[model samples]
Target: MAATEPAGSRHRNEAGPVGDQVRANLKFFRARQGISTTQLARLLEALGRPILATAITKIESGDRKVDVGDLVALALALRTTPNRMLLPDYGPSRGQADVALTPTVTVFPDLAWAWASGKQQLLAAEIALGHGEESPFEVLEEFRRNALTTAERQHADHTAVRAAEAVLSSIRGILDRIDNPVRYDVEDESRARHPDSAARLGPAPATPEGLRARLRSLIAEIDALIGDDSDG
Candidate 1:
């Protein structure tokens, strides 16, 4: 009990053969990776496990006893099997990282999953590779062209949106200025002729209908940019 736990409480799974078994399994994994305990702990943190380097040292030294869940977490972090962690002698034949590794365009470096990102990037890479045998640089060059085209299309769409917004803004400014035309022209004689001219013209109505028509026109221009040929 004291071997598993530091001092106060007894371990449910005491350290006799159980402790030796865990330690042996850990050693097997360590040998396979040639990874130091410190490095392993850092790798775990990188994999979001958050175990301290000191804690890993303790666990490896047989001073800190790990729970079953901890063992599972460690296995997952190391990208290995639970069976491999438990029975180190029966460990999977080396370099599993090499197995999962593949050439891909790293669009979002933070994203780890294969499916949920930049499908076009994956598709483009696959298409580039599928072409009749080419040199490595030639393959990459194909992907680069496709990537650039995709990026340019995205940029053009974004610019189209901004252009439409600018057009609407211009139309609004024109209509607003026309609605309450500022008579900056100083006309002393005209003021005298029309005594209460400010009161003569009641508040101007909003140009919602006219603005809506302009908005529809602007949308049609945008739709054309997006290639909405179905409306034809």
Candidate 2:
């Protein structure tokens, strides 16, 4: 029998369009960065996973295969992200061309870029291509639900942060007032405009003991907000 290829080796060697794109991008980015193959190899060596300059040249020439680790290393050496290296040129003029994702599957460059950049899912592309029997709306609704949940959580977190920042700003203003009570007449005028604010603000703490008490209360409020955020 002919000698068998090592397990997984054949797959690596036969990496198709995706691999070709990565190789092309590797060369593009390296040239843009004005780095030679020897320099890139040295950078990879410094990263502790050395690839020979000859191997880097072969990878750029599409004669050598790059595994995940090598892909990451090359990205770092080239000062670009792995997704950038994985995607074909997607300029406006080039966007009309289809990028071969596999031997059989090709997608528009923009769709390929979106998928590679994590802005959209491959399932969306499959649905767009009418490759599945499932209702597109139903499949997309599921993704929408997931995306909405993530967006809502992010919004909540941002709101909580803003609230905390406002509270901290109030505390800092209070401290400044304590430091120079006569300098902040604007605050007093505001307090006068909204008399109910004084009840929430409390009388400006006059002494060291009063300031300590105010700081303690503010710290407690911050802790409570943090606890609620963590629970959420």
**TM-score of model number 1:** 0.32
User: By summed lDDT, which 10 consecutive residues of candidate 1 come out lowest?
Assistant: 92-101
lDDT tens readout by residue for model 1, 1-232: 3447557675465455545556677777777778877888887777767677788878878888877777877888667766555432411222222111133332222122222222123433455457557665675556445544676556635756646654565464445445434422244345556768834632122235445555666677778777677876
Q: How many residue pairs of model 2 clash at the backbone?
A: 0
Top-TM-score candidate index: 2
Report the lDDT tens digits of candidate 2 across residue range 33-135: 8999999989999998899999999988878899999989888888888888888775434224678887656776766765564334566457456767666
Compute each candidate's TM-score over C-alphas: 0.32, 0.53
For each predicted model, how many residue pairs clash, with residues at least 3 apart or on different chains?
A: 0, 0
Model 1, residue pairs in steric clash: none
Candidate 2, superposed: residue stretches over 4 Å from native: 1-13, 94-96, 122-133, 141-232
